[model samples]
Target: MIPPPSARPFLDQAGWAGAEILPLAGDASFRRYFRVVEGDRRAILMDAPPPHEDPRPFISVGEWLCESGFAAPAILARDLTQGLVLLEDFGDARVREHLDAAPAEEMAIYTRAVDLLVDLHEQPAQSGLAPYDRAVYQREAALLTEWFAPAAGLAVDASGYTTAWDKVLPIAEQDVAPVVTVLRDYHAENIMLLPDHARSHGLGLLDFQDALAGHPAYDLVSLLQDARRDVSPAVEQAMLAHYQTRAKASPDFEAAYAVLGAQRNAKIIGIFTRLWKRDGKPRYLDFLPRMWGLLERDLAHPALAPVADWFAENVPASARGQLDAGQSAQ
Candidate 1:
């Protein structure tokens, strides 16, 4: 793969000039990743073009994770003006792919993942991070009405959607859970398994640039109610129990989890729809059914009664399934 011309000077300054650049992956955003190899030396090149993405949050959070004894990729070098950063390579053992290859290891690997969160919550909150407050919550949940509803050919009750969130979102903001650094996208696909590291330090964290100071339950919900993959109900329950036991979570934690789960799933449904409609990426439509399934389960929780009622009244059962790829909101 050819390195972007802007990357040449950055790599040279980082002493990685002439390294072979191989495309690694790209996510739901404008950012792209490439694995840089120069003989025995290796690192990751994060190309987050400006006006669309920034690398500072990523660098800040990564450095904090390393200092806190976690496994976030280290930032080796940076050129913020061009939105390029050199990060320590965490290798290719993603937890999602790992579990796919060895289904029997699901319980064990997930146990470790839960333990990692338990340990992370023990640290003091990282100062200067954004607070995942009510406004952000309401705005995110509105993605469903703003994008998905139109695409599904249903004109949703947008105001009622906000009102429902206004009622139930406070349950998540309750003092029942500790406020900690919430890795907003903590899920199987973003976690790496480092074979050389001990079990406690085995999992490598990624995509945490959007870290926020929020209730500890938010990240846990993100992990259990994953949008990309179906984490079995049995496994989800077990992990939730495991997290509660280890973290000594409050009795109200489950309520918070359900609320956040519904909120996040709504946001994701909107985001995936936006990605397809606005960004021209139809592959994300494939995950809509799974997202809807997870959202429905969360809505069943008593904590989500307000939001559930809104969805029931607005988004009928028929409109809550797979979206038509041919439909466009543009």
Candidate 2:
């Protein structure tokens, strides 16, 4: 693929003048990635357009992860003004791809991923990170009403949803212990299982620019309750139990997980809907059913009664997954 005119200057400045730039799959963001190859040497070029996307967070978080004994990509060259970074290549073997290619390795691979979290939570969180506080949670969950409600032909107002969430916030925020560096999108696709590397240091991470200081359970929930793929029930249960046992987490950890899971799934439903309606990317819609299912499970937890009650009152059973253009004006 021909590099975009805007990207070529940065690529050339990074000494990839004669390299072949191949398009790599991008995430649900404004940023784009390209694989650069110069003979046997390789690197990844991150094109994060400024004024909308920033590369500073990724650089800072990458440094923190590397310092913390994890495998985040090394930044070879950067031009923050242009929002471009040439990064050390981690190859093309993502954990999800590896598992799909070799089904038998699923359990062991996931265990290692969980173990990485175990190690991360033990260290002190990086300084100056934002908290995944109540406002943040409520703001994110608002996407469900703002975008999904209209797309699904519902006329639900955001006031009731916000009020209900306000009630649930106190209970959900309790027993959260302390927040860590929550890699907001820790999942199979973003983690690499480096061959021949030690289990603890083997996993390579990507897409962590949005890391926040949040409950330890949030990242764990993102990993196991993935939006892109189905995590088997057996594996999810085993991993959850393992994390609780290993982390020596509080007795209320399970409740926190359920509440956060519900909140996250609710946010994603809005995000996916927005991605399709606003951003013109409809592939995210296919995952709505799975998201709804996960949200249902989380809502069932007694700790999420307030939020669940809000959903039951505002969103009718028939309107759960249906999308149209009837969203409330506010």
Work out the TM-score per prediction.
0.97, 0.94
Q: Report the lDDT tens digits of candidate 1 across residue range 1-330.
A: 455689978998999989888998789888999999999998999999998999999999989988888888888999999999999999988999999999999889889989999999998779998899999998898898998988888987799889989999888897577789999999999999996666345999999999999999889889988888789999999999999999998888888899999999999999999998898888899999999999999999998998899888998998887877776536
What TM-score should be assigned to candidate 1? Answer: 0.97
Scored against the true structure, residue 186 in model 2 reaches a CA lDDT of: 94
Off by over 4 Å in 1: none
* Runs in model 2 lying further than 4 Å from the true structure: 199-201, 322-330
Instruction: Encode model 2's per-residue lDDT on 156-234: one tens digit a residue.
Output: 8689888878876666578756768999999999998776457355889999999998889899899999998788879
Backbone clashes, each candidate: 0, 7
Taken over the whole model, the C-alpha lDDT of each candidate is: 0.90, 0.86
Residue pairs clashing, model 1: none
Task: Determine which window of 10 residues in candidate 1 has minimal summed lDDT.
Answer: 194-203
Query: How big is the positional error of residue 330 in model 2, measured in Å on the Cα after superposition?
Result: 16
For model 1, how big is the CA root-mean-square deviation? Answer: 1.3
